[model samples]
Target: MIQKLRQSGTLLGFVLILLFFALKLPDTFLTARNLINISQQLSMLAVVAATMTIVMVMNDFDLSVGSMASLSGIVAAMIFTAGYPVWVGLSAGLLVGVLGGLFNGFLVSVVGILPFVATLGTLTVFSGMAFLLSDGKTIFGRDIPTSFSGFARSGIEIGDIKIPMLTITAGLVIFICWCILEHTNFGRRLYAIGGNKEASHLAGIKVVRLRLIAFSLTGLGAAGAGLMYAARVASANPTQGSGLMLDAIAAVFLGMTMSRRGEPKVIYTLVGVLILGVLDNGMTQLRVDSYVREILVGLIVLAAVSVSSLSKRRQS
Candidate 1:
C-alpha cells in the first residue's frame, strides 16, 4: 500500500488539495456559480496549457504563443469593428496565428535555429506588430454581435448549477486532446522525440514535420483562446494576452508533475489549470493580495517541478 501510494502520490495530492479548498470555502466554493466562474476564468489558460504541453512533448517550446494570442485578439477586434462578419474576423485571427507558428517552424526546422532563440525573436516581433496594429488603443463598441458573445455567455443548468459555455468548450477541447495524446501514434512519436530526438530521427519519425505540426497546433489553440477571451470581454486590446504566458506555462509544468508517464498529458494539464484557478478564486474570496497570490503560484510550480524531476531521476 505504501509503495502504491508513493507511485500515485501526485494524483492523491491533487485530490486532497481540491477537497481542502472545497471544504474550507464551502459557503462560496461549493456553489454552482463559483464553479462556473472558476471554469470560465481558467478556460483560456487551459487552452494555452494544452498547446504548450504538445510543444514540450515535441522537445520544443514556443515563446511567441502569448504574443500570437494578443495579435489574434487585436486583429479580430479590428475586423469586427470595421463592419466585417464575425466569422471573417475569426478566420483572419486564426490565419495570423497559424502564420506566426509557421514562421517559428521555418526558423527552427529550415534555418537550424534553436527553438528557444527562434521563438524568442518571434515573440518580440509579434508583440511589436500587435502594438503597432492597435496604436496603443483598446477597441470597444456596442455593435459587437450577440451571437459572438453568446458563445461564451450562455450556460447550461444541471440541478441548481449553471455551467458556462466557455467551460464546456474547454472541457471538450481537453477531452479531444487527451484522446489524441493517449491513443494516437503521432503522440507516441512526439514523446519519442522529446525523450531522444536523435533516436526518433534515426527511426524515421519525421521530426521536422512533427515539430511543425506541434507548433501549428499551439497557434490554433492560442487563436481559439484569444477569440473566446475577446468574445467574453466584448472588446480587445493589444496587451490583453500579456499575462497568459506565465499562467499557461505554469499550468503545463504543474501538469508534468502529475503524470506518471513523465510526459505531458492533456488531462493533467487541465487539472493543473483547474487547481490554479481554484487557488486564485479562493484567494480572491478570502481577500488575499494579488502580489502574495502570484508569489504562492510561483512557489507551488517550482516545488512541483522539483519534486517531479527528482522522482523521474530516482525512477531512472
Candidate 2:
C-alpha cells in the first residue's frame, strides 16, 4: 500500500479530496447540475493551467498568462465589436498569446534574464496593455454578436448528458497538451531540459528553441482561455483574468507529485484544477468564508510543494 501510494499519490489525493467534498456536501455537491457547473466554471482556468504547466515543466514560469488572457480576450472582443469575423478575432487572440510567449522566451533564453524576473516584468506590462485596450471598462451587448457568445453557450445534448462547448474545448486542449508532452520529441526535450538544462545542453539539445515553444504555448493557452471567457460572459474586461494567476499556478504545484514524480503531466494538472474546483464548490455550498477558503487553498499549495520536494529528494 505504501509503495503503491508512493507511485500514484497525486491521483489518490485528488480522489480523497473529491470524496471529502461529496460526503460533506452530499445533496448539493454530488448532483448533476453542480457537477456541470464546476466543469463550466473551471474550464477556462483549466486551459490556462495547461499552458502554465508546459512552461513550468520546462523549469520556467510565465506570470503573464493571467494578463495575457485579459489582453487576448479584450483584443478578440474588440475585433468582434468592430465587425470582423469571429475567426479573425480568434486568430488575433491566439497571435497575441504566441507573440507574448516568444517575447518572454527571448528575454529569458536569449537576453539571459531569470525566468522569474522576466515573466514578472512582462506580467505587469501585459496587464497594463489589457487595461489600455479596454480603456479600463467591461465590454458587452449588441456590440458583441450572438455568434461569438455561441462558442461558450453551445453544447452537445445526449439523452441524459450534456457537455458544454467550452468544456469540450478544454478537454481537447488537455488532450493536445498530453500528446505534445508525452508523444513527441519536443516533449521529451522539454522534460530533459527541466530535469537538467546543463545536461541537456551538453547533450546537444536545442534548449533555447524548446524553451521558446514552451513559453509560446503558454501564451497561446492563455489566449485560448481568454476567448473562452469572452464567449461565456459575452463581454471582456481588463479585470476579467486577474484572479486566475494564483489558482492556475497553485493547481500546477498541487499536482507536482503525479506519477511522473517531479515532472507534471496533463492528467495530473487536470486533477489539480479539479481539486481546486471541488474545494471551492463544497466550501461555497457549506457557506465557508471566501477568505478562509483562499487560506485553505494556499495551505494546500504549500503542503503539496513540500511533499513533492521531499519525495524528489528521497528518490534522488
Please give, for residues 178-284, the per-residue lDDT of candidate 2 as tens digits: 89998999998999998999999999999998888899999999999988998899999987887788889888877766655457777778988998988888888
Off by over 4 Å in 2: 1-7, 311-316
The worst-scoring run of ten residues by lDDT in candidate 1 lies at 1-10
Backbone clashes in model 1, listed as residue pairs: none
The per-model lDDT (C-alpha) reads 0.81, 0.86
- Model 2: weakest 10-residue lDDT segment is 1-10
Model 1, span 237-288: residue lDDT tens: 7878877777887787777777666577787788779878888988888788
Cα-based lDDT at residue 167, candidate 2: 88
Model 2 global lDDT (CA atoms, 0 to 1): 0.86
Q: Which is the leading candidate under TM-score?
A: 2
User: Model 2: what TM-score?
Assistant: 0.94
| Whole-model alpha-carbon lDDT for candidate 1 | 0.81
Candidate 2 residue 244 C-alpha distance from true site, Å: 1.5
